[model samples]
Target: MTTTRTNKAWASNALAFATAATVTAIVTFTLHARVAADETPNSRPPMPVAQTQYKLQLSFEREQRFLGLIQAASRSQIGFEVPGAISEILVREGQAVAAGSPLASLDTQALVARRAAAAFDVDRASAELELASARTQRRAPLVKSGAISAQLFDDTRLAEKAVTSAFAAATAQLRALDIDLEKSVLRAPYAARIGRQLLDRGAVTQPGSAVFTLTSIADREAHIGVAVEQAQFLEVGQIYPLQWRSQSVRATLLAVRADVNPISMTTVAIFSVPADVEAFDGEPVSVSLPRTEPETGGWLPLSALIEGERGIWTVLALRERDNATLAVREAVEVLHVSGDQAYVRGSINDGDLVIADGVHRIAPGTLVAPISSSSVTLAEH
Candidate 1:
């Protein structure tokens, strides 16, 4: 019984030892396989990246566009001085007229009759005054020669003075009637274009009521609202370029108003447009003014920019590592963005090679084959 038990124990020990050896060999083989895999070369090829060289600038000028409107230099609502029923309208809307050109006329039948009566009264007064003057001259000689009583001669002279006063009053009334006759016709005060016809023929109108809207054709103006700070840079009488319907035109600076525009919150600048240029009143226009900003930065295509943590921006730059070009991230502060480019100042140096585009395909420290883009011009703004 003792021998059999000992044999059983020996078999059990042998089985345990074999199991331990198998486990140890399996672990060792797994570790060696991992080591061999690590030593193998990476199968993925290097990425091709377009690159541009960074060039630093001291400052940049941003073109600012200001919107404005074109207008006539002189605009007025024209009407007649005297009130009457309109008899004729000689001018039409959009008609060009010169100074003193007849625009409209009032019915002159009543004025003409009154003028004739006044003229007849004037003629009767003149004849009476001439008879009174002759009587006064004859009485003066008789009173001096003592042929007539002094009181009687004095009474005749006084009677002649009364007739003379009546004659003078009649003459003044005639002159006033003539003035009314001339005022019946409405004429243009200056060279202008008729903008609107407010009244038609035979329409009765009151005095000072607008009959037509006149806009001067000889002079034009541009009213532009610019920021108060920018307005200070403009000088009166200086010439500036303006854009009208995508075409460039020159205008002279006329004045700058002191009050700020309520809607735009900007100061107003008046400019005189050349008469030779054709433009309609109240047309929309714009002007570009160069605003220089003092900031040290460099320009890069917008594609090179990468959104970083906490609102900061990142740019990938190429560096020499292990005899191969590798992409490295550089933090930048974006000063200005215009068009497809941005002005940035940051950890990048002037002469550093920067990846221009396709940033999402690679990570930092990524090996890349840089394709030079030196032929392309850098952003100027």
Candidate 2:
């Protein structure tokens, strides 16, 4: 029994040893296979990129389009001088009117009757004054000759003075009535167009009540607001082209307000338009300011620039590495971006060979074969 038990223990130990050997061989083969796979050449290598060198451009203009409105150069609100119910409105909105043309009328029947009564009083007072003058002359002669009592002569002089005073008062009243009669009719103060009608005929209006709004047709303006930086470029008397609804017009810079507008936080610029150009108040228009100052930068195609860390930009330039063409990165600061072009300055000097496209396929120190871009349009200075 002891011999049989020892023989079974030996067989068990041999099985354990064989099993350990198989596991060790498997682990060793796996490690060697991984190392060999890493050392061997790749079956599918990266294809060589067809690269292009883009030339640098300098001197560009910065322009921004702004929107504004066409407005009247001068506006006036018309009102009646005397309080009365409006009797007639003779002018229509948007109608051109000459100076002194009647725009509206107030009821003048009562005023006219008073004016007639004043005229009649003036005529009667004139006849009485003539009779008083004759009596005063006759009394002067009598008082000097002592042909009549002195008291009677004094009474005659006093009567003459009283009648003369009455005559003067009546004439003053007549002159005042004539002025009121003329004011009953509202007339255009100057040659202008009716912009708006506040009240219709028969509407009761008080003195100084706005009845119509008039805008001068001979002068028009473009009222636009711009940032403080942009305002510095504008000068008084400078002419600029303005567009509205496909219509183009030229306007001369009339004024630039020093105070900033509270609502838009911009400075106001008023440009006087041509008198013949048909424009209305508050009509929207567009204007572009030509930059007089040249900016120091170079323009590159959009494909040449790459986004970098912290909102910075980068470009891959071709350089010699390992006796082969390799891409090297250069930092650039984008001054302005227009459409598919980027205007940049910094790090990238003039005549740098920057990759125009396929930047994603290229990395720093990447091997490449660069060729001149025949089809790409290079930016001009």
Lowest summed-lDDT stretch of 10 residues in model 2?
A: 41-50
lDDT of 1 by residue, 107-143 (tens): 9898889889988988998888888889888888888
Highest TM-score against the true fold, candidate: 1
The residue ranges of model 2 lying beyond 4 angstroms of the native Cα positions read 1-61, 64-67, 146-162, 246-248, 290-296, 301-333, 338-341, 353-381
- Candidate lDDT scores, in order, read 0.89, 0.82
Best by lDDT: 1
Model 2, TM vs. native: 0.65
Tens digit of per-residue lDDT, candidate 2, span 302-338: 8888898799899987777556677789998988877
Over all chains combined, what TM-score does candidate 1 have? Answer: 0.71
